[model samples]
Target: MNSFFSQPTLQLAQSLIGMELVHESKEGITSGIIVETEAYMGPEDRAAHSYGGRRTKRTEVMFDQPGSIYMYFIYGMHVCFNIVSGPPGKPEAVLIRALEPVSGIALMEKRRYSSWKRSPAQARKIMHLTSGPGKLCQAMGLGLELYGSKMNKGPVFLKENKKIPASMIEAGPRINVHYAGEAAEYPWRFWLRGSPYVSKS
Candidate 1:
């Protein structure tokens, strides 16, 4: 609830639908069009890591500036990325749920599948490239190494591409937060309508 955010977490999530998230990595650059996002309101939303003002080493970056990269390991094997939101002292973030590959797709395939050399049929099934958080992180070479870093000052950066009109966006409850009590029903997830690259719906 401050000026540094530019807008609320929910609004920011919706606005990111058409923006490009680019990664300059050792293999090469890979970029994607953000097609789905979910916002976790600071301290109050049960689904948020900072809910009830809980703060720890891993959750610290969520209290930083709006553009800090918040990456965390989950399910023992996957990494999920989030953009810290809300102003300093207020912990909130927007989770990038899914992306649509836009550039360096071969390199993305290399990173994710360890082989860009795919059969003609394999190449056509590109929806799995960046359709989910963990999948996109692997495709873009994002990991825990970039945790707590500034998005605009490192290998990862986001840029505006084009605006997705309001009519093309949809909102719904976030994925996999069924244990968050009544908060599970909060319609905080936003995604481009009819985007096949979205993880769900």
Candidate 2:
């Protein structure tokens, strides 16, 4: 599966849409089909954490081989998951922005909600379970412990799924990266059309 990510940053980001992300744990198994993604062009792109060749303990994993997990904490709270992309030392990565919950809905709701108690009608809003990057990470039991894990094998990994057609994919500028100046205008974000699970439309 590592080879799956060995492509150009933008290409890999678009390709990830519709693939399945699965997690296994003592609690249960949780899975989702990826529906949205954003690419960080690295080095030259001001939006990238590895921009300007900034290498720290945290950013080091982005320089690893393709398919390495690059999880990070943001806003002093939320955890965002990224998959290392491109060749070794390139530092490019694809941010998994949203997912459509596919399996273990109950376990996901338990993890997402404080009380794990909800009416059947209220529970129907399953799209909210894994609708965003941080939410999906929490629902799937992913955290710093899974950082740097190989995506090809682990409690957390990507699985093959039905291919998404090019026509169904929508591309636009990345979200919440206004600080990137001109780079913020780059159309690196991709998502499935009409997917309620997308982090943003």
Candidate 3:
């Protein structure tokens, strides 16, 4: 298993700048170039820890060994997945926000179709296929079952790609974090510039 993913939170966040998110499902192994991500660092990060350092059964996995998966349900529906980083006892993770469809586009299209009732063309146009956090997880077939799973040696993991130039990368505040107060202002979100796959510009 590659240790790059097991590094510190900030390192993983920056190293993942140019990588691919490969998803293997019954449909096939669909891959996408990672275009956007956000880092949530431990209890101190007000944007993280719903209980603010209070660990519950749901968040217990976050305190597990690094490289574990931390998946949670939101909006009573969607599953958002994150890869835990940093040392044990220090909860930190990188959120995969957007992906540019690279391989197995057809499979992605089909999986996305099953989730939302949209025509192929409309799915490709209006839906963004693998854009939003929830949409990305849906298209990748990720859920609680994948929580605490290791991605480095599993069916899903990050793979290296050609280095994206600095000019092509941009940073901004995370989305839908109004409740985080000052933490919402943190510019932890990073994305590829001019990438159509980005959920938001």
Candidate 4:
């Protein structure tokens, strides 16, 4: 993989449109066709915690070197993973939203099946397993333990997948960001149109 993540935040956000997110974990190497993503521009962007150059314990990592992982928990559950971008001191990142199962479908099925055995039918639905940020992280085994991990050369990273087409790419508003005020309206979300892996887009 040629470190497709080398680009700047916004460029990476756009370039990641058709990339593949691969994870080599104890369970096995599970790969997914990235279908959705959202960009958070550094500082000035209210939607980004690093906005206004506000640096806190949580936001500190966002200002670190680009290509680092910035993961956080929400709703007392759900771990969201973001790829840190932009130069040092500038907090920016791209939030991976959805992914289409490519390799290791069986392993994903097993993990999701174990997690949602009560609703096995839902487990059969691939989108349900990785459509949302939390679901994607859970399916990929990403967590706080992976915080600060390098995306360019880690067990998990992104690679180019030419199977995806530019025409299939689409952009829209990010999910659940009303708390960001006007920033919530920013159409930073990008996705592969009509892809089964795409969350209710």
List model 1 lDDT by residue over 1-201, tens digit each.
224345678888887889999999887899999999999997889988899999999899998999889999999989999998877888989999899999999887777776445653454468998999999998888999999988778899887788789999999999999889999999999999999999954
lDDT of 1: 0.87
Model 4 has an lDDT value of: 0.81
The TM-score that candidate 1 achieves is 0.92
Give the per-residue lDDT digits (tens) of candidate 3, residues 40-118: 8878888886336768877888788777888989999888878887777777888888888788877766677865655
Residues 83-201 of candidate 4 have per-residue lDDT tens digits of 88888778898988888878887787677677663755542666687887888888887778888888867798877768655677787788887888888888888888887777773
What is every candidate's alpha-carbon RMSD to the true fold? 3.0, 2.3, 2.2, 2.1
Give the poorly placed runs of model 3, Cα more than 4 Å off.
118-123
Q: Arrange candidates by lDDT, descending.
A: 2, 1, 4, 3
Instruction: Give me the runs in candidate 4 sitting further than 4 Å from their true place.
Output: 1-6, 121-123, 163-165
What is the TM-score of each predicted model, taking all chains together? 0.92, 0.94, 0.90, 0.90
Note the clash tally of each candidate: 0, 0, 0, 0
Global fold similarity of model 2 (TM-score) = 0.94
Candidates sorted by TM-score, best first: 2, 1, 4, 3
- Candidate 4 has which clashing residue pairs, if any? none
Candidate 2 residues 83-186, lDDT tens each?
Answer: 99979999999998999989988899878785545654454478788888899998887898878988858888778899899999999999999999999999
